[model samples]
Target: MDPVLDDHMHLDPVNGRGVEACEEFADHGGTHLLVLNKPSWHYGVEVEEGGDFQTAYDHTVDVVRESNEVLAGRAWPVLGVHPALISQLVDRGYAPEEARDLMRAGLDTAAEYVADGRALALKSGRPHYEVDEAVWEASNEVMRHAFALGADLGCAVQLHTEDGEDFTEVAEWAEAAGIRREHVVKHYSTGGVVGPTPSVLADREELVRAAERGIPFMMETDFIDDPDRPGAVLGPKTVPRRTRWLREEGYDGALERAHVETPRMVYGIDTRATLE
Candidate 1:
């Protein structure tokens, strides 16, 4: 059987259902997941300095560790500064350059976790929402810093970006930073990226459309796991359930590539081994 994996999901033990969501995914046949840290603000960590991000990052690592200890399958952690932190810092009277420095420093801390094998990948990106040109440029700088760190750590980088991003310019940044294009993934992506691999959301028609493009890609639910808005951006069970739906629709080959081959290439994780 092809191992089912969710490329992006969150577990907020404090504010949400937490590991119970993992149980839901597992119950529905998920074999593996990449658990990411929520933004620092969500954890009530006022980012005065880069070291402040350690609290949120540590929480995420602990959550993944606990989830792995309980789950029969596996969970890998992804940690980094959320790109929207730029606006938060500026709103609190930070200069764009200062915000950029803080975010880069935060990613440096995240890279430390990756280097120590406490996390599997680093997550960073520019704001998906619009901002001033200076903030946008600063956000890109922070994102490029992530790519550079990924090159040094030899781990994949997951990006949260605006919809319809072609990623042509991002490909240049990856190359200049010495990280492979495929090593950068667009999380919550609906395809159409030219450079970074697309971690496509688990929608049948969208999956079919992405798979038909003949580029490497993977599937994700981007499950937020918030109690206030349960099942937002799809649910915990969406990936495995969608995998079953695709298999039923005779897309077995595509499923194998998405669930197994593509993840191994991009994340260096073999879901087959995790399943075993």
Candidate 2:
């Protein structure tokens, strides 16, 4: 088997012992592993300990930095707010005004991290934040800001959308807002608030439709082995099969062209690195 590129995985130096896991993954046939910066609370940070928020951010940074060293340049880091954390950013620490300010600063910090080449993608989820119509609109507003920053920074936007909503809404908005097709990618995880099964039948239809329209798309397993985690439903060993299925389903050709051919044309990445 050729080395598989796992595009979306979260590595926490503070928990799940990601450094060791990453080394093991590389030793066992993984070629590239993309890590996303997640909230400290996800790793069990106590709310009372000032949460060591800076330490959490630094921890995520260090993991990516070290992973790059270990992999000899195969690690790709993605930094952005998880949609669930968006409300927390504004509703948690300060007066409503102050909270909004802090949230903006936090996003700026994320941008700076990306500017340093620590992030290859900006990760966000729509289903996590869209609890109501107002929240849905607000979620788009937030995504607009994030997308703008991501575009300026030369990073891709990885979006998580509900299965049924017209994701073309996203593509259309991006086009209207001047975001290029190459800069936006959608992650179709297998299960969760938004996954393959839960995805509206219509959404799946739209994905096929979008492909016909020449939109860039990708499928990700988003699998985690921890039994307590929601993603564990899609076991690790199931990843390859899922990839094969997506390929059989037609999303493969486009994704391969983007990750393999197009990147080579633009960045001079050796296509041999993607050989299977």
Candidate 3:
């Protein structure tokens, strides 16, 4: 009974039930969750608002503090200056490098939070396929800085990228940026873990796929906290429920790898607690 961990979940107000969601997860045997806060949730400001470097930085820190309070130490925040936020700056007359430097400054602040142990992970990277090449390149540049920052802070970095991007390529990019492959985890990634790197997946099938490939990965509900689309990604209870289901499905070995081994070895979550 190793402590069950949800590699990803969101508990923001836009989902409109942050505290209740936390309680539901804990009640369902979720010992720890990788919590992410939306920019709009923390600051009244969105990228469209064009907040300056300090404004964005402080907002990220505020989200960290607020999320930690909500979890009461059961979770930590993953902060980053998402490419979409930088796209806003680009629209406002920032050159690619300028936009990236501003995001770099945001990661600097995020790195400090990890150093203080107010947080455990950093989220940074390029956006989806529809982005302009220039914006995407700029975003990668900023993330290079971010990867190095996480490496220095001893934090795992979760990448937000296209759904089926190749792991070897992403791992190469992280290494080129001085981020160890083991330190880089992908968000919303398919269960095709090709290397020693870990990825977050959505369901038992994905987990089974990765296991069949002899790949390592972690599972996530990616539960967007949108009340309108409640359980849009998956419910807060999904991870623990899925873990139990996998155990019953005779995939206990894969479940143990994903729920315990990979999370500890790849993401480096605290594993001092053993399931009795």
Best by TM-score: 1
Q: Give the per-residue lDDT digits (tens) of candidate 2, residues 1-276.
A: 433455556666765556665666555445555576666567665332222444556666788777766653366666665555545543565343343334344556677767776556566555553465655555666677666776677666666565543355576666565666445655553222221111111134443543454433332345442335734423333334444544579676644643355444322344356343
Model 1, residue 158: distance off in Å is 0.4
In candidate 2, list every pair of residues with a backbone clash: 163-199, 163-200, 164-200
lDDT minimum window of 10 residues, candidate 1: 64-73
Off by over 4 Å in 3: 13-15, 40-42, 46-73, 272-276
**Best-fitting candidate, measured by lDDT?**
1
lDDT of 1 by residue, 175-261 (tens): 799999989999988755677899999988888877777678899998887888899989998998889988898887888888889
Write down the lDDT of every candidate, Cα atoms only: 0.88, 0.52, 0.68
lDDT of 2 at 158: 67
Q: Per-residue CA lDDT of candidate 3, range 1-276, in tens?
A: 455677777666432676677677767766667776565424455343223333544433454355445442356567666657776777789887777777787777777767887667888878776778788888878877877887677778887766664668767777776767877888776777553265556577776677666566778888877777888688988878877877787877776777668778766765435232
lDDT of 1 at 188: 85
TM-score of each: 0.97, 0.69, 0.85
Can you give the lDDT of residue 128 in candidate 3? 70
Clashing pairs in 1: none
What would you estimate as the lDDT of candidate 2? 0.52
Q: In order, what is each prediction's RMSD in angstroms?
A: 1.1, 5.9, 3.4
**Model 3 TM-score on a 0 to 1 scale:** 0.85
Ranking by lDDT: 1, 3, 2
Off by over 4 Å in 1: none
